[model samples]
Target: MAGKLQVGLLFGGKSVEHEISLRSARNVYQHLDRSYFNPVLIGITKKGNWHLLEDIDQSIDSAPPLNLSLGHSRHTFPTVDQQGGTGLLDVIFPVLHGTDGEDGSIQGMLQSVNIPFAGSGVLGSSVAMDKLISKQLLKDAGIPTSKFIDLTGQDISKVSYEQIENILGLPFMVKPISLGSSVGISKVSSEQEYLKAIEESLQYDQGLLAEQYISGRELECAILGNTVPRASDPGEIIVSSKYEFYTYDAKYKDPHAVEIKVPAVLDHLIVEQIKDLSLRAYKVLRCEDFARVDLFLKDNQTIYINEINTIPGFTNSSMFPSLWAQHGISYSELITKILHLATERFESKKQLTRDYSGN
Candidate 1:
């Protein structure tokens, strides 16, 4: 392993997507390039404890996603020396999504240690993870999003039933201001469901985003690379059940919960529009490496840009890889590409002039 790059695969964070992250890490670990890279598994438990895993499979029995205690790896916070030795990581692929991992917290830490990782930087990841802020930024950038309001802890407590009813209106989407995997999301149809929705939402996030639910087809496009990023053919997500929207169970559990139509059923022009919008949104947020941009298409084919996942799911079943596979890129190739992008970004950052002194 002298010349082989020691790649750190970090996953299973203290977010709702913890389990999903574990599944993704397992897939990547089982598929990464053995010739050029030596992938090391770093599992972070739900309590925000970090562990260096010696045997990845042994940790599967732990209840809370991936547990470091189960593996030979000891626990530590987010750092290179968490393995209890010199920080020898050549590159970090943070597979965690949603909160600490996706919201720029981990990015900032990695930056401080000068380690190159996959996905967006602090600014891009932070903005992309926040639904309310991302929506505002998109709106400012001329991208269409549903009408919404940012409800802080103060605002949430003071608002009355009538206030909630009149302002956000009923049959709306309620979710944490910055979360993914549809963790604390709910669809409230009446006053009876409004308070419960808010209560459940508060469990996951401090800020809340209550937006007008758009009735249309759900579409997604995978964006890869930086500066001149490329977009995969659009994919449509159709929930077969009578669920108000695509919830956590619909995305993962039920086998027939949702049908993903690859090369989405749409006109070439509409596909081009979605691909372009995906790129625009990716660039606007200053995202790097990769992202999965979700969109909503109306009956007339009008497109509204939804949120972008800076570090989208990369499991074999994930839409991102699925879309790329349809375009002739294998999963191994995708992983290699992502690793290359990480190195590219790290090298570029190393080239920047960070010395600031009066001369």
Candidate 2:
């Protein structure tokens, strides 16, 4: 532990995915190579309070809630301490997802403090978090994605069920534009369900996405690196008959909800195409360190890009690590690699000139 880099593992937030973030942070803490990383736990409460934890692997449900009244100084960043203020974190591995955590808010805070964290920067994180923006960027990049329409603010009131059915057809998907883990998603098969789905989805976000249903396989690819990212073997999500799609409950609560197939069975050419598309999507989104790109593989062999998760889950059943595991990279090694990438990116940024005087 003499020369080990101090890493602050930040988790929990005001987002609906707060519990998921806790689970992810625990998995990362458990798998982190202690020999090279002196991990510190920094937990944020649902009420937005920040507190340092002594035990990184402690269950969030059992732990007492943090009630620190850190004042109303919104500009201040939280400090990480491992040994009674005797140490400071060299880098941060934010295992946080959704809203305040994944939507560039936390990333912006980290950047203002000049601290390096894993995953995308503010611009990329914000863009990726918004489904509408991400889809537009992918479309501009010539990536094939499902046809969709964005409903913003009062626009939700102007949506016509008949027009939607005419363009995207029935059984379309209604999603809250900036959420993950399928927190606010609905599949509408009829006109009655269409209105209800939109109403339910708008509760989570003002921006809603009504996308054409792609009746195909759910495939995902994990990408890693800074400059030239590499994609892992693609994985497929086999949903149970009971569920129409991968819902929040099916993802975290239910054990037998879905089965994952790593390196999804496909022709060699299709596999190559998926990997290439995954990397291209990552670059297009300006993602860094790591991300999970979800796509749809149609029965006719055509592939469509879905969306990218800058901070993909690290839960035991998460697909990002599983995909890399299929490619011979162990969970511990993957965590180490991400940490190294954070440091490398930080050092590279430090080398750039921040202030310039015209010569």
Candidate 3:
């Protein structure tokens, strides 16, 4: 207890994926190695408030408030820690997903305060969070992402359905620019569905993207490490015929709607290819520590990048953990490894000269 690092598990955010965050936090809290790390559960309300929770599954109430400062995070101990404690968070594993949690806002805040946290930094988080921006970068980098058209803001009104259909083809995907968990996404074939899809997507974000839909198998690759990142065994997702695509409902609302196959069955060559492309995409996107890259493999064996999840789900059954587990790494080991990566990154940054003096 004297030498253990206090790890903050931040979860629940002002994002639509709040519930998913809660689920992820619970699993992380359960798997956290108590011998080496002191787990501090922190929850955020929908209205954007942080509460230090005594219990992992505590509801939003008048819990002891938590505040963050330079270098370390500080919180009250009288009520927040009934175990009687006073210490700074050595590192934070933000178990939050989507919007404010994954889209660089929280990352930027943490970085500004000099707080060491897990997952990608501000740039990587922001770059990967925006669908259109990330696709454009991928195209520039010659990464194999699917064809997409920017329908953001007035651009959506400027592009006609006929133009979009001509470019993206009959069955296209309309998606929000800054969201995960498959929220505000739709596959459009008809003009009516396309029009309605625009409105539906705009509900979650002001920007939108129309991408070419490939009739193919979906694959995911989990990434870990800092200086030199590594891609986990490729995983596959089998969407039920009941759903046109992997929708938010299919992702969370109904668990059985999709089958997840870790270390997806593939030829040695194909598996190597998936690993290569996944690593390339992860590097091009500037992702750090850990992330999950989604890709589509067409029947012809062509692979196209779908999107990247900077702060991917961490539930027991999530692909990130499952993929690593398939490689013989347990869930607790993965968590410990990620914390080590964060501390390593922080220490490296601390040695860099932050100020300049005339010599």
Candidate 4:
């Protein structure tokens, strides 16, 4: 591992998507180029404990529980033994998804520690994690998105079904604003379902977003780089009819529940539009390194931007990598490219001065 950059792969958090993060991290660790990058596995338990795994191949489910208190260990950053030739992490590649992982919490912590990590910075991650903020920003930027109404736990009690129906109409989507992987998201077609969906969503997040449901194809495009970002070929998520939508179960648990079509069957003009919009959204969000921008394509070819996933799933089968793979980037190369982007961004930031003095 001499002369190789050590990459700490951080995953598995106290979020609902913790299991998904484990799967994503496993794929990232397996695909990371050992000759160029030394991968360090760091797992955060469900109870918010961080532990460095001695063996990367160990199953997260079977790994012995870590009883250490939070922030008790100063070794969050792994060190290298020059004499023993063990690699020390030069950068972090967080494969964590949702809540604490993707919501700028971890990004801010890394910033405080002055460590380089891949993906969007704190501002971008925080904004993107909140659907209300992201949708408003996108709307303000003239990016097309489904109309949504923001609601809090207290607002739900005063809000009537008739009021919501008059504003958003039937068959809308009720979701916990900050969560991903379709957790606590439900499609409401009836008054009873609407009430239940809102209550259920509140369990995960205090903020809720009820979006106008646009009946159309679920599309996704992958974005990469910082200053001049590139968008990959758009992909389509084909969910089984059995499922109401791309639920958490559909995305992970149920095999054959979904099919991903890279370079989605569409006119060349439409494809270009999707890519263009994807890049615009990435820039608007101030996203760095890599992200997956989901969109909805209506029957008339009208496109509406869905939320952006700062750290989309990284499994080989995940949409982000699969979309890039269509553009001739293998999973391993994608991981390497992300690492390079992380270093590039870090170096660029290092050039900035923290304090200014009058000359």
lDDT of each: 0.83, 0.86, 0.87, 0.87
Candidate 4, residue 201: lDDT: 94
- Model 3 alpha-carbon miss at residue 352, Å: 0.6
Give the candidates in order of TM-score, highest first. Answer: 3, 2, 4, 1
lDDT of 4 by residue, 1-359 (tens): 34988788989998999988988999999999988988877788887767667676675545544332223233234433223333345889989999899999999988766778999989999999999999999999999999888877677777777878888888889999899989999999999998799878988998998899989999999999988899988999999999999999999999899998988999999999999999999999888999999999999999999899999999868899999988899999999999999988998898999898879
Best by lDDT: 3
The residue ranges of model 3 lying beyond 4 angstroms of the native Cα positions read 69-87
Question: Which stretches of model 1 miss by more than 4 angstroms?
Answer: 60-87, 157-170
Rank candidates, lDDT, best first: 3, 4, 2, 1
Cα RMSD, each candidate = 4.5, 3.4, 2.7, 3.5
Off by over 4 Å in 2: 57-87
Deviation in Å, model 1, residue 295 alpha carbon? 0.6
The collision pairs in model 2 are: none
TM-score of 2: 0.93
